[model samples]
Target: MHDDPRLEELVKQVRASRKYSAISEALVRRIGAAELCKRATLQDAVKATKKTLHQIAGLYLANAHPPYDAWLRQIIQAPDDTARRAVLRSIMNHHTSTRERLPILDAFYARVLADLGPVRSVLDLACGLNPLSLPWMPLAAGATYHAVDIYEDLAGFLRAALAALGVAGKAEARDVITDCPTDAADVALLLKALPCLEQLDKAAGAAILDTINARCIVVSFPTRTVGGRQVGMRENYAARFAAMIADRPWRVERIEFVGELAFRLTR
Candidate 1:
């Protein structure tokens, strides 16, 4: 049999990079799940694996719901802070993971922003309705925020919300896997997004981190899966994330909160 150079090289790339080790595991998980999803076929395993991979290669996030767009629009039209916060609650309750993280949003934002002094601009990657939490963030007056998400309708609603609130925030539909946005900012957020990005493309995720022009990058990961499973996720993700930055030029600081893990990186 002839040697397959491409597969050999891919194996070398996966084995040599510790950061990619976690990504490789994620791929294995996907393949196993996909395989089981087609187990009735009992034939053409390669075809099934290939088809499943293509379907997911460019997926951005798992918890996307277009039905929330109307709720976001209502929040933008809210008459007062009391009304807006109430509207925000409805939006938050739509997703359990986001809902859990938001009640402590004030303290969470304080910790992420406090360490990165004097922020004038922000970049929020894969920003779900988290951009709606802008009211709670300790942002400088007139600080410009640029955010992106794959859900165009949700992003459009956020763009309208930013204008309604008189904050200099911009939300646009984007696929970070294909074209990661890079604008200079005092701080850039990757909250609970790295794993998803890596799952899409580890090379793209690493490249996004390497190329983004920001003073600090804040990364957060969930301690519990969306299904409420807590099978060593924190330790597993943290070790892989540390490996991702092992050769990069940044000072790392870790912040731990119940059911969540965070890191502040500055250079």
Candidate 2:
């Protein structure tokens, strides 16, 4: 019997949460039917049960990442274009502010787009709300802008955003893990997505780089953890990222920002 006061309080809170109560009951039913391990203390037993129930309903843990779905819901309900734009900006990751993310975006149009030779097409992969930042990307006339994400809701909102912003672009929902992206564009943006992809599958990041046909691919990673901890994450990701693309003959141009590490990989 582990008589921890902290454990007792945690169990009480979980029991009181309506969202978790049904899930907890389902778990207890399974455990009881299977004759699972017994805890001497009832409170301790509840705490352990709560943890198992939480894992079973882990989809509710969307609170950990960017609130994209919630923001999208709010956007659809917003009254006007201005209000929708505000909702869209609210979901931008911590790297960027509610308005413009970083100072680099000011010169981004000139640096990435204009300097990349003839970019009549752009492909944004695992692109969150970046298409909303089209104002920052000074694309030439009649350029085909394509964005992709896993969530269908994101695709719907992004397509609406593009039309509202008067940008000639299309957004598609895709599961990059299962299906490979077949879009061909002059420039592809894979911003802060490698680490996330790697978490699902170890070789997915490299596979995506190889599959996407783009003359110039711009890849980025966060310099610090979401908690703002610079615990050697930058150097670690940098080394692995560089090694991942080393096989290809990519002329990598590195850009170091306070929040993110970016590379413009071209042949």
**TM values, all candidates:** 0.74, 0.66
lDDT of each: 0.69, 0.65
Top candidate, metric TM-score: 1
Candidate 2 structure quality by residue, lDDT tens digits, 1-267? 234444444545555665454232323433322222366554555565556544432332333244555655676687886776565555554223212344455565466565776677889987766776675676777777898865455577678767666678798866665565777889898887787667546898888888988999988887776556788877888899888988888999887766677789997
RMSD of each: 9.1, 9.5
lDDT, candidate 1, 20-58, per-residue tens: 232233343344344544555423433454444334322
Pairs with steric clashes in candidate 1: none
Candidate 2 off by > 4 Å: 1-104, 107-110
- What's the true lDDT of residue 259 in model 2? 68
Q: Where does candidate 1 stray beyond 4 Å?
A: 1-69
Model 2 C-alpha RMSD vs. true structure (Å) is 9.5
Q: Per model, how many backbone clashes are there?
A: 0, 1
Model 2: what TM-score?
0.66
